[model samples]
Target: MADSGSEEIAVIGNTDLTPSESENNLKNTMVEKGTNLLKRMEINVAEAEKRTGKNAVNMQETYTVYLIETRPVDAASEGTNPVPDSLWRRYSEFELLRNYLLVAYPFVVVPPLPEKRAEFVWHKLTADNMDPDFVERRRVGLENFLLRVASHQVLSNDKIFYSFLTEENGWKETVFETGFQAKADSRLKALNATFRVKNPDKRFAEMKHYGDELQSVISQLLRVRARAADRLYGVYKVHGNYGRVFSEWSAIEKEMGDGLQSAGHHMDAYAASVDDILEEEEHYADQLKEYLFYADAVRAVCRKHELTQFELEMAAQDLTSKKQQREELATGTVRTFSLKGMTSKLFGQETPEQREAKLKMLETQIEEGEELVKERNTECDEYVKSAWVDIERFKEQKDHDLREALISYAIMQISMCKKGIQVWNNAKECFSKM
Candidate 1:
């Protein structure tokens, strides 16, 4: 049971899951999925073009697509090791991957992907406006995203992962599911397996499950927060370009300054206000990351407890076997055993006295082993209890903090939006007067 003071800290159905560490080697056992992906595969955005349907009359009906080139660097199979192969994928395809990662690994902060703009008018206008420079920029962003996913611990090892990097016939034309429905079942299965304790036990199962849930929720929240930061950067970057475009137009800043001196400053101020909101959002994201850290701590402790129990069980079995062997030796049952059992005697016969001495020593060793296991188990249990106390306290504080932060962020974003509308209105008024 967790500490009473922090009893309110519950993951599922108000059950308090404590944060503790038992297996020091548990972390070492974690396979870095992302690293393995990077070592085995490389991704590059190759030839990009607009794909059209059977009808050639309407060229504008075509949508932009890119050839995703996958290079297998070091595969063991004869046919697997090869030159780079490629496949055509639309922006929507990449979008699916982003959504899949966000939905699946709720703990991971999926990188910001390029925004979609499939509008007819926008596409028409940007036909010539969308230069190779801009296309390359977006491609780089997409490539960076794949690299990030490749390095991610959970995302890298997913079954659907191969479909992403491989140009295998079926997957080459694979259509991705959209929204939360995309990869939901597979993600849940992965999450269940990912959170499972190696040494299974009932008491620790719920704790591990709840811990995983908390980690996932917290991670998703952080991903949202980071996305806000990404949005801010996007806004900030465009705002700079806006200023540049304004500078190159109609004596720009000076002409605009003639009408309202504060107009330019007001736009900057509004951006600043939005940026502040984004900053706050990013901070909340960071705070959620801390919660994930605590959740992981709980899992480590739970695993340690499980491993200790396993050790205890094995030791008990060993003790039982040793005692049985001692009884058999004392009763001369060894002499009546089969050929294999007496194979050692063929090499060197053991006298009755020698056999008795060996049995006594074996019994002493098993007794000592049992005692050691018992002591270790007691120590592990104590640690588990202690960890639960800390987790409960931590849950009370972090959960409260997270709630407060969410409220604060909502208020800030709302306030900023209102301020932005006012500033834009002011700018419009100032410009009309000019």
Candidate 2:
């Protein structure tokens, strides 16, 4: 007789189980098998842990699992084509198997579990062979996973998980930490080195305190310099004399130079201990540029104002002097002519026509002087008016420029404050994570 197991078997179609009953039976079988497997795995892990003095493994700790339910797009239409329920059921089974293998025999390095690999099988079943939505979802899931890993300190520190998650193959947290620390240490050392160079000749130096004071003084100086510039500019606009304005500017410049020199000398003397002198030097350089700009503006205003005032004053003085000389000349000529007439009358008798002629000539001379004086006065007034208008214009421009500079400075300060807060927040996070 033929072997019983080898005998051919055939089943005829019979109206026996409904589709829902068949699905329920499959689900029951899957639940039973999964429960059994889970029990066995737990027993094995417990035994291993007892022998090795390690904690028992748990499913949550060892594996990450995701479950998805898919429904047919046209499920509402009875006759419309729909995704077979078998495909979804098969996919679920595969996922369960994959998760089990990943947790139960993590070191085995086996090929992906066959039942859990239904996504690939599904792709083969489709004629168009594309699941764009599924692909997009998977991509998004992977990206999110990576972001979590990167942000998580524990997972990021784990060599195995970190290597698997990151694109830089074989990367380790320890190695990364070492490199970061080395860079930080090098930067610190460089800063310290700078201190040494700055303080080479000093002994028992208070570099930190000195540097702080230096910064404070420099800040005050900057403010003072700004105010000085404003005042100088104002004075120059009103005075309009290059010579006078420059003279004042020269004095201020000297004062600034002296202040800088004094600061430098102190820095040099304390160089053996001070570390941030170079920073101070850079600050001073910037302040110097601002100071110079202010000085130039003031000088421009002063020169213009002074020249206008000088012209006006000179014109007025010349007119006054001319008027006085004209009056004296007229009086002297009349007296001289009168004396001659008196002498002629007492000794050699003179005519009235001669006296009248002398008087007319004196009157003509006086009238010419008066006209010259009047013309000079008119010029003086015009010069004064032009000078005043220019002074006002210069004042307005100076004020506008100052206002713009102030606004820019304020904005910069606010930006810096915001950046400082952001940096502090990042540092706090880093510290907590570490």
Candidate 3:
């Protein structure tokens, strides 16, 4: 979907997502300051190990943990450098960190983690978690996820991330103390209670729509790729059968027997090459899957923006209603029919002192409501600016990453075709000699 020249899917900031001049200037200043404050850290997930583990109940279980190595890139003053820090973390722990990030930084499009279990895999690819190839691919993906977070101007500076990288012991307890999961649950409940936004920004609406479209397109692509790979595998296996038939026929020949056997060998080699080629293709497919999962993160940001806008509108509406009530009280007239006015008419008009007291209470509430409105407005504005800045950065990264992935995939396909052609050409020469 992210074609090189097509701005439809790749370009997120050119439209209403573009910030105003003041916001743009503010974003630039904030980014510059953030860059200076955040240190560059090298993070890697170089290996994985499957280990037998004991559960809380003393039950035995098996699990895999990844080795994470991190070091401050700029720590060296001139020559001497500190030793790199290393830790082993379960995949579940990575989930914990990512969940915290999503909750803590709702405005940011947090990077998605690789799938814990494989799906839509072909025959050659196993769904088993402990498969060496699958584990290696996942390790690479986890590394990429860390690199993405480590490179972020905002995410890089998070103390929790540092703790996740270096603090092997009591990390979960530290994360629990932050109460992030409780906050996320509370937010989810609020969202579930009210799914409507009175006023939605057009930019975020477009972004949410883009997220859906991107997810859909990428998912369909992966499905097609899997199906194509299955077919390709079968084709290569059929050629292997053809090679066997050729060798068997050569056994009954005389002068051309040698040529036929050699041609059969060439076919066998060509057929065997598909295994490695398809294995390499899995790497490219993983890249596509990365963007496929990223679509969800984009929607999460949009949903957070909508929540902010909804709160702002609710606050402003409450302020307006309070002001209107104050005006009606002072004017001795009801702008709209109310139960309180009917009650006053049936019982008796309140004394001037009581009326004045009620007016003062209304005035106090009006002031507080006005302040709340202003605060919510400011919150909404800041969220929009910060979210847009990150979105702009994300769009650039997405474009570059997808472009490189597609280019590499194309090169791989071209090389596969050339190798196939060479194999057949060699077979053809053997036949010519015969």
Candidate 4:
């Protein structure tokens, strides 16, 4: 967060000027700017009032104010990291705050009154001005704003936030009344100051540095696990040639298992860190579910492509029986094993030519199974992509519906506000005429 220099209190609509026209001229200019800003805000408020068929004065209240300041710290030194120039330059805290207010105000202001037409202007005004926790309340509002932005995974992507302006039902009233608007405004001001001092490039660089390190650890672990699985698969496929494949399989398995275990441990720790920051328990659970889905998909591929337990067991039995038969022949005891019995052989060693042929046949079967697994994996990837697309589309539709509702509500509010303002204005006119 960044500071907007020092804070100075200016009268809401001061008109008096002393001897210095220069000072007065500047003051007048600022006043006009402030007035215009307020008028624009009032217009929005009026629109909300009209749409809701509620009087604006009935909802008006004094809001607490707070200020947040951001200053830069040396990146090379302790307790500081640099941010990217692009982010600092492009991101606007003010705009974000404004958006928050636009969404949250309506819900916070004006409780239901029994008589919809009843005038509660004085009561509302008095309550707003008299609240003792105004300043503290404002601080809480700022905290909420920060929490929402920092914790929002979708918005953190940056692309998503930039691409769409999400709308909500009766957003204007929800934002202002809830004090989300004020809080967001303050936080944005603070963020602006921080961006100016720290810059976005430095911040992004730090994030990338950490992200890469974490990803590397995860990658290493996955590779190790995959290697181990491959070694086990090779051993099962070797049939009677266990001695030939044993040494090779053992070495590969050792290397892969070590790496995989280490990487998995690191990933688990990082995930825990993420969980700590997320307040909503369900959010973390949802993320876990998604990760599990991906993991299961990967396992499904392996299962489809690799040799099954039944195939491995049969191969092993056939190899043992063939070795026994060869021993008997060497001892001049010819024991005939029928083709039917050979067909049930586990290691697939029957006749000399049949053994060779079976090996080739098994190889072809394995390849075909692997191809099917690959196709399934591709389908799974496509499904994941389609799911995300659907989610984005749903969000867009939700936003549209909310906007329509808000506009309708705002129109009603504005009509009511205009009527109130008109009555007040007319009273002033009548007073002047008198």
**Top candidate (TM-score):** 3
Per-residue lDDT tens digits of candidate 2, residues 1-434?
11111000000010122446324323322112112212211110000010112224532332222222223333534465554331111222333332322222111111122111112111112222123333323333333333332222112222333223222322334334323344334433533442212212121123223324544554566656445444533432333343233344445564344433333333233322212322222233343333333333233223323333343455555556555544544454323345554665578633466546655775675567567556544543443343234334434543564466557655654764464465445434533443
Q: How would the candidate models be sorted by TM-score, starting from the highest?
A: 3, 1, 2, 4
Return the clash pairs for model 1, or none. Answer: 20-301, 23-304, 34-151
Considering only N, C-alpha and C atoms within 3 Å, which residue pairs clash in candidate 3? none
Ranking by lDDT: 3, 1, 2, 4
Query: Where does model 3 exceed 4 Å of error?
Result: 1-39, 56-58, 74-83
Measured by lDDT, the strongest candidate is 3
Q: 2 or 3, which is superior by TM-score?
A: 3
Cα lDDT computed for each candidate against the true fold: 0.55, 0.33, 0.80, 0.32
Q: In terms of lDDT, which candidate is stronger, 2 or 3? A: 3
- Please provide TM-scores, in order, for all candidate models, with all chains considered together: 0.46, 0.26, 0.89, 0.18
Candidate 4 achieves a global lDDT of 0.32
Give the runs in model 4 whose Cα sits over 4 Å from its true position: 1-365, 368-371, 381-399, 409-413, 429-434
Indicate the residue-level lDDT of 282 in model 2.
25
Please say which candidate is ahead in lDDT: 1 or 2.
Answer: 1
Clash count, candidate 2: 16
Worst 10 residues of 4 by lDDT: 41-50
For model 1, the stretches where C-alpha displacement exceeds 4 angstroms are 1-199, 209-217, 236-262, 272-277, 334-340, 344-349, 428-434
Better of 3 and 4 by TM-score: 3
lDDT for 286 (candidate 2): 44
Q: Write the per-residue lDDT of candidate 1 for residues 179-229, one digit (tens) a residue.
A: 345345554454455332345666567877888998788767665655656
